[model samples]
Target: MQYHYEFILATMAVLGILFLFTFFKTVLPIRRNRMFRWLLVAESVTLIFNVLSTWYNSSFGQVPLIVINTFDVLFFIGFVSRDFLFYCYIESLVQERAPAIRLPRFLVWTVVEVSLLLILTSPWSGIVYSINDSGYHIGRFYRLVLYTNAYSYLLFSIGIVLAAISRNVLARIERFSLIGACLILVVGNIMRMLYPTYLLMDSFYMISILVMYLSFQNPDLYIERKTGLLNQSAALSILQEFGKRETFSVFALVLDDFSENRRLYGVRQMDAGLRIIADYLRTRYPDCFIAYLEEGRFMLIARQVLPVTTMCRDFDRRLQEPWHDIHVSLYLTASYVAFCGPLQVERPDIFLNYVATALRRAEEENQLVVIDEQERQRADHDAKIRAAVDWAITNNTVEVYYQPLYGTKEQRIIGAEALSRIVDPELGMISPGEFIQVAERSGSITQLGEQVFEKVCAFLAHQDAVALGIEKINVNLSPIQCRDERMPERLLAIAGNHHIDLSRFKLEITESALADRNVLQNNMKRLQEQHAVFSLDDFGTGYSNLMRVLRFPFSDVKLDMSFVQAYFSRHNRLLPAIIDGFQSFGVQVTAEGVETREMARELTRLGCSILQGYYFSKPLPEKEFLAYVARTQHDPEHTIRF
Candidate 1:
């Protein structure tokens, strides 16, 4: 019996040393997680108590069973305390963000209250010990103590299950480790309960320590090193498995200016920005499966059909929001395609390919474009448009049409916006929207814009006498065309060569052009210095932020047709506010696409200086536009009708 005590002491001492080393190693890396550190402290205390109990039993003469039972109670308390710490550690691990200190407080207090109640009742009060003449003593309440120990182990086992369900990825892995420890505790307690005299069951506690050592040794097994939202490989495997199940909607959000950001800010700062974005996405869309797809791009998978438009808009807003001593300008676009058909259970790689195709199409169009089978067919249509664009560039198939901008009070044409018309001869006239996009994509817009500018300058020069009555001739500029460093100089040179006054020429830039503030500012400054006026065209069409409008230098602001159309609607308050806002900036306002007397009346009431639309006259060829201008000038009282 004495030899059994000595063996137990030696075994526990060795196990305690190993457990201490493992705890120190694991805790070093995760020192920031205060709960995990506390767990190690609790574990160390329990191991110390185990060693103390073994030593107290072996060194002393045959002690009373009651004294041994007191040590047994202390051992049980230590076990319970250690198990509670394990639960806390597991919960902390899975969260990975911040540990909930209150939860462990509640749990520990509850356990202490229960233990105090059992102690006050003194369940083993009268049956302290049974000593025979042989001096070998045994406690009468041994079975009751064994039952209490078993109950404690059962509580810990339930805790493991609870922790498993409550945690995130990191917490779940820690829960797994806790579950392993709990199982060993349960088995050891059960073995001791069945055979009270058995000291061999102490080996199971050593096994639990060994399991903890294995769990703590590998950092990769526990915490995600990058983005700190589970690692990419782990997420990919899970996503692959999930794809094998029911249908899900996958979204691939590609940040357009990620490379620009990387160049502007170093790689380290870029990574930090990505992590912040990841954390925001994870918190907001908890159910959505998200991962870093590549540099400046992320992939999201959802069990439900996510509102892609709303999500994309919200995400863009969030990324652009001011953060920590830095205000980032995020140029983000997201494209998503839902899977509900036979391809529901397709491989993740294949699904990702389809998503990539959709993203590419969206980026090409610079809009949130979806790629269904119908959209795929449009790709073929787009190819035809591309061919037309190619012909237009080489053969000068793009015809220049002029739209007259008439002054309501003056009853005369003040300017004309140069519009492009594509006549394929074979396919006839193509829609401007359809072909212009292709031209922009094919890099033909730079040449196309120059051609249009040259023609307008020449037409102005030839009609200088007749056009002197007109204040300015406005030529629309594509956002892509504005980026070219040579565009302003080239346009000024062409006007100078044609002997046309640059003051008589106004270049109309879209609201979208304001998105690139640096380019817009530089071009506007250079053009203004050349005595050319700048006008904001299609103002309310794309991302009409009031702040951006205030920043731009504009001689005129063209209120888009959508706002003009809405002027007659019940919510007409916005129209006046928009007009007043631009006018307040000392910018002249032009109401575009005015098709009704009511719209014209509304604009006139709001003090709109210039008006253009079907109400005046449709965009006409050069010869027809001249004739229309002549007729309008001659007949002041003629009410134009389409």
Candidate 2:
């Protein structure tokens, strides 16, 4: 019991030191905030009262009886007055618009004042706590005094929580801490009431105030240092509060070249520039709360939508004039993403993503601001595609279609091209070209590649390819997949697992992708060592002409149909020479889109050994393609007559 008293004294001392440390830790903020100062003084007074009451009661005869009694009375008054002081502090924290304070302000405080009047008169009736010549003794109704004050505050607190339930507009962490401290206070008081020998209510009430101060009262935790704007967490918290309203908009501004400017100006000078920018933003929208997100990103909360186009144009007009300070002068490009809401309250991050992505899309497209119906529609469409692709990948519903690639000289089917297609029960037949990029963007391209490859390999394994004279089945690997270091080996593993030889499958890489031979070149080389064949696909479409083609270690080049169409329209005789040149370089040439029998005959004469087009067969399902193979072998030359 003696050591327990020492611990109590020691804890109170530590609590005072904590308050002092927090006070100095955020000296500038505390200096500006008088209510916060009163909070500290009130807590300190209550702690001093507790320590004095403890000593007065214990050393009853050692000290003067009257002095001890006076300490006891001051202790009870301090204990009771703190509740009103804390209520004022809490009322200040609440925003004026909050519904909890809808009641007449003076009326609420008046009731608390009358309760204090009853508590103050308790000393006369000896109801709260009393001091006699014997010692300081707990009054008969001491628990009533503690509960009445606590429950009154508790009722006010509950009103605040319910009012702000839709969004945490209040000092949420402090509110939570207050609730927890109240619960503990109630529990501690009930236990002490059950056993009248113990005195725990004062210590527990001290805890209630201490919890709020430490958790939510610290400004440094939520205020940005350089700009003094609400920090990232505070900004988001307040934004959620604002989001609860019916109509609000956010201007998500990203200061372009932020890191570059930081590098040029140095950290300290950059901070000064940011403060200037933050101040400018505050001036522009004086009533709005501006939040400085990390690395030159800032968000503004506006209760109503503004003309985004006009505002952004002015932003550019002002910023383009050049920002000049003592140390740095530069032109800064800022991008804006704005969204008016009936926001997606369930998914708050998505609401932000919609706006932030518009800014990114605008900057990327070299536009000023791209927050229009089309941009939002694109985001929604992409979200649908992502969800569809995710479902296809999960359910293994991704279908592989086979288009037959034929040898011109052999006049029979030589290989089939495998393309993954998605025909969602709802989204009906999504083109791989469209969804493949979606997969890449969503970082599910690898899974998509593996899914397609598994189907292709399984199809090949199921085929009587040797009997059909089908030497290989060409598989298209997305450029994103090719960039993966393990993609080649991973694909080889898939083929090996399906008991399909690497030689029986050819992975097609776009000519544009192969231009950077310094790239996934090693991945291809590793695959080549394992006898996996590679082909340059859509050869003519890339920026680089024969230069990328010559260095590429492809077994062949699949000419794009565009060249065939061009040849037919323009009657370019050079197409024959191009084919011969490719063949001479030891890369086999294949003519794509060989629609007419005449085109096929001409390509054969031009030294192109293979032809692939809808003329032979459009991309067919697995069973249909196998039947096509049988039909092709029987009448290869006459399948499509000139």
Most accurate candidate by lDDT: 2
Report the error of model 1 at residue 105, Å: 77
Enumerate residue pairs that collide in model 1: 93-171, 94-170, 94-171
| Candidate 1 structure quality by residue, lDDT tens digits, 291-365 | 676656567666677787778778667656543336544334344334332234233444445555566666666
What are the per-residue Cα lDDT tens digits for candidate 2 across 411-483? 6788889888888877788877679878876789889879988988887777678888889888887777777
TM-score of each: 0.48, 0.61
Per-candidate local distance difference test: 0.64, 0.71
Q: What C-alpha RMSD separates each model from the true structure? A: 20.3, 8.7
Q: Name the lDDT value of residue 553 in candidate 1.
A: 80
How many clashes does the backbone of model 1 have? 3
Winning candidate number (TM-score): 2
